[model samples]
Target: MVQADERPASDTDLITLGRRIRHARTARGLTLDQLGERVGSAPSLLSLVENGRREPRLSLLRAIAEAVGVPLNDLLSTEPPSRRAALEIALDRAQRGPLFAALGLPALKPSQKLPIPVLEQLVGMHQELARREEEAIATPEEARRANTELRLERQARDNYFPQFETIAEDLVTRAGHTGGALTHRTVARIAEQLGFTLLHVEDLPRSARTVTDLRNGRIYLPPASTPGGHGLRSLALQAIAHRVLGHERPRSYGEFLRQRVEITYFAAACLVPRTQAVAFLEASKRERDLAVEDFRDAFGVTHEAAAMRLTNLATVHLGIPLHFLRVGDDGALFRGYANDGVPLPQDVTGAIEGQLVCRRWGAREAFARRDKASEYYQYTDTPAGTFWCSTQTGSGDAGAFSITVGVPYAHAKWFRGRDTPVRRASTCPDPSCCSRPSPDAAERWAASAWPSGRMHQQVLAALPRGAFPGVDDAEVYAFLDKHAPEQ
Candidate 1:
């Protein structure tokens, strides 16, 4: 009987190795025989390796990479280097992991004789390479996935962080925000209470709204963020939230996103504390006109801030259920939160983070409104129910984004804009929604007038897969371990 080879090669390893060799060989425009001659191997063997028919040894792979004028790592790694470097990676990970806990021995790489620093450097290099691989893959999709997961987590917590709110309320009370509004005095007091010395630097980075130098306890604000009447009070609140929350480095990407949400929540809570906000809402709810602008005027905050704060009142105090939607200029729903069974557009996984909003909705309509100070009011009827939405569009840092506060028809009578003649029906899931083209458009303008807005995409040679697609599981585990706290 013929004895089968005991050390059989894996299908995955062979396929990955084969693709890498083929790509490198083709890039150099070298024939099979020409490359084989440089590698000191026969053309047939090289061809077999390229075709994934034969598993090449480390020596052969090294020679091939050298012949192709590339490093061994370049040829061996695909989208994920951590998995491709199997044996060395496993041993390297085990050394850092619980496997060698009792041994009290030093960690080792492929060459066990290498010293600790050398091994650490090698592992660090590997980690950097693996991160590069991950970046090369899932640039857009992974970001969207992170957003979707973040939204789900926030929803799980009911979009309200009680702990953060409690802390924010305490801070606000200590700062003496007895009045309903967060005046300049209260804002400055809040900053002083948080131990952050506020400074205004005009020449800060163009993208920088606020910068906190933790060591010196100084919060620098760029004037560009708030060029008009008052400065960025919300920015101050955000920086204060970062400090008072005592938030360390978040472990997972999800946790990092979660912390941002919590920080923002804390900031908003400080800006408009629930105790005062609820009292104001209760007072306003009694009036025939419940205006967000009225709330904005009374609180001395942004229209968007007033709108968002109203969403908190739904579950917290007033018991008026509502939904909030913030859409970009391009009709992308950037921030959306709903607790009143309002159906948000989502994927099969029930993720609404990156979904596009129907152009017919009030959120989209608000963008076209050139009057920056004016609010767009619309009573939209969807499959869910009739929602009365009032949105205010802003320019500058807003980037033409619209902030909307919507309530069900049953609750619309309490709002100010409910009586406005603006009304629209949006059957979002139906094919007819936003499908009809412009009535004034003609066949003559078809070729030249329409903007394609085409963007280039990098063509990946092949999509690679591993236990963790383009990521290192060990690195992720080690990170979570740090944030896990001592058991």
Candidate 2:
């Protein structure tokens, strides 16, 4: 019988063996399906063995050798398992020191030898980590954190391996079984399904051919075009490989699995493009007012995706400072900040008195539109800023909502201490509000909410109907100027 480790003599030998298997099946006058049934496997599996899609398992080879009326040793004479090939590749990497150096990792000197046990230990540790990663499966909080980390790592590596563009294009071609060169129609179908377009793809120049280990997959592209070609390639490989190696595990370990997945390369590449998404965002004047829909149209992303991307954008990238706040009828406080990471003040001490913030803002605007006498009341009062522009949707009074970009005060304090006074009003405005301390104390604690952030803001500008306006540039500069770190 063939042993698992013995290598087949040559490609010719493997092909001859495949041919023998085919001849035996044919001689029996049994269809491939019938032969597959005898082996307790799929026809495709048997066919792949004959066509070399995979190396034949020793057990299968033994059975096939018997079925073919051949001596077991004849079938056993094949080469060692595929793992040997993988080992050889790993050794070659160890030899050049380029593998480590390319990844901006310390290179192992040629004179040094890695202890076999130590290497095994590292692999074992990876397996253990994989297990730990899977244990917390099904928790929404964990899933979200995993997704966020995957998005960040993938975005970073794709910036390095632009050649993976070719890999993606090739994958599309290989996906079809017909084995023809990829045609425009096929490419278009794949692109449309994936929601992306490959632009400015070109072949690597022959002079610069270099193979980079994208930790998960190998990328063969021209080298020396940029600093640390090998390093970038290795980083990209690792990012992708981490995802691939762990994908089979459950959601608890999804981050571990996804890290080995090669898809990270594509995601990262999409983000840090040759031109960058921020350039388009700036060109569109989005900093003035970050409307999720407007940004979505420009990037071809969903509204949520656009908003998240905006949160990641740096002022340096867009040449304009950006700030984001989450506001509701309750009031506005800092939810998050990007680029410079300005912390929203948690201690808001003051309250807006006698303000019909959410309810009367729109009515005041409509009334102002009809007559000059009512123009003074047109501005809606809120904690963030004057209501400049908005777009509303949903039905029933509570469903309608709007987002307004407000100018924050130079030293605005958004959060006040627990001891800070809350206005006298209902126990809890909405019974469904989970933030309420106790269900029993709901209605009695509801706040007579006013605009939360900069309560003093007066409406100097307003968006026309149907527009979701953003904070103005002058207002942003003023806010930043006031809050700028004192020299």
Candidate 3:
């Protein structure tokens, strides 16, 4: 679906579009031909317009409204923000098309004058109804369904794709960066071999770690601001995935995310070659519990990468069912991929990403350590089941982050820290998981808590809530801004 980033500031009036003529006509019990006769348009043509297959001339749309006994604006507006904004875009494009010329509709811009009452109705739709709709899901089950679908897709692969692994291995071998170590020099050589242009900008926006300017064919890398110096190569591979895999504009949010999953998997597989990684893991698992830091140290990758690589090995190589978590210092889960069918925290929209995880999990508790250099492991019992996890702390562009790899307690014997003295029990999804504020708990740590830690951010500059939930528009802005066509 086309993203609604181009919704004009002056076009806020178009938001409500509370009703569709199709809905109004169905309410009136009139057939398409009956309405077409009243509006002097063909039934087939009217159908095309309603389904977004054909654009109705402005005059024809007005006639359709008058025939249906609904205001013209009501016929044009849809309830969803993107749909309503798309109507405006469609109308603008239609006005500039050949059909409008044939119909003799006057040349007009989006700002051109129209009846004030129509304008007022548009404003009402844009302001009131759309705002309410934005905060909620059309169907509560939909959010849950979306998360389920993503989970199913992840399980479908069982966390391994030999096709992508083959591509990664082949690329690295051809670049002569095979065996022993995977370093920044290795990533650089592969990037140059792949003909990627890396540009480190003087004024790189701190808000974004990397930007892809496809227009200029340059990947903008953030400076040494991020602690791990491996971000540039990772970012370049991510950018390369779009072109390498011939990705197209996603028709839906899920499809967009699926593309992202494929890209990250490919990038990770490239950095930690399948043949080498599997061999290294086999040796490590046999020697002792597999330590993720050793994997990270071997491949100069981020802690998050090492965690993901562990899961990547589970299905084909390790025969272990694992779960991965990318938890932020603030307790938000940036990523959750599990093949074990364990219950993970989900946001209001039923997404694991961006959901606030239970504080007792190793991923969250690792952040509380006085000695972060030391590895942490937790044998935690949850309502779903017990999981043994290994967590390590890291600093990234998103601030302090935790990368964790966990397997069901039965499989813990295969991982490092499985026998560690650390342990915790969690009753999350039940209000008792230690999230809610209580008087006794507050008193004990009241002095230590930041008394004035509230950010109190201004909402004036924030982007409007659109179709997707938990999407940060600033990231979208950075991505699109970097990739927008050259003027």
- Which candidate ranks first by TM-score, i.e. highest? 1
RMSD of 1: 12.0
TM-score sort, best first = 1, 3, 2
- Model 3 misses residue 400 by how many Å? 3.2
Tell me, what's the RMSD of every candidate?
Answer: 12.0, 24.5, 12.8
> Candidate 2 — worst ten consecutive residues by lDDT sum?
411-420
Model 3 over residues 1-487: C-alpha lDDT tens digits?
4235322223323222322556677668889889888877789977656555454456666677788787865565445334444444445445555545655658543332554455445455444543444334323344345555766676778878788889888878888875755666666676677666676665555455556566566666666556556666677677777777788755444555567788888889888888889889999878766888889888888778888887878667878888888888998887788888667887565567557889889999999898889678898899989999888888966599888888898888877787888888899988767777788987888788877653524312332233333345576576667655578
Better of 2 and 3 by lDDT: 3
Model 1: per-residue Cα lDDT over 30-70, one tens digit each: 98989988989899988777655688767677778888888
Q: Which portions of model 3 show Cα errors greater than 4 Å?
A: 1-151, 195-197, 203-228, 347-349, 396-399, 436-487
Q: Which stretches of candidate 1 lie over 4 Å from their true place?
A: 1-139, 156-158, 203-209, 224-231, 366-372, 397-399, 436-451, 454-487
Q: How many pairs collide in each candidate, listed in order?
A: 0, 53, 5
Model 1 residue 151 lDDT score: 69
Q: Best lDDT goes to which candidate?
A: 3
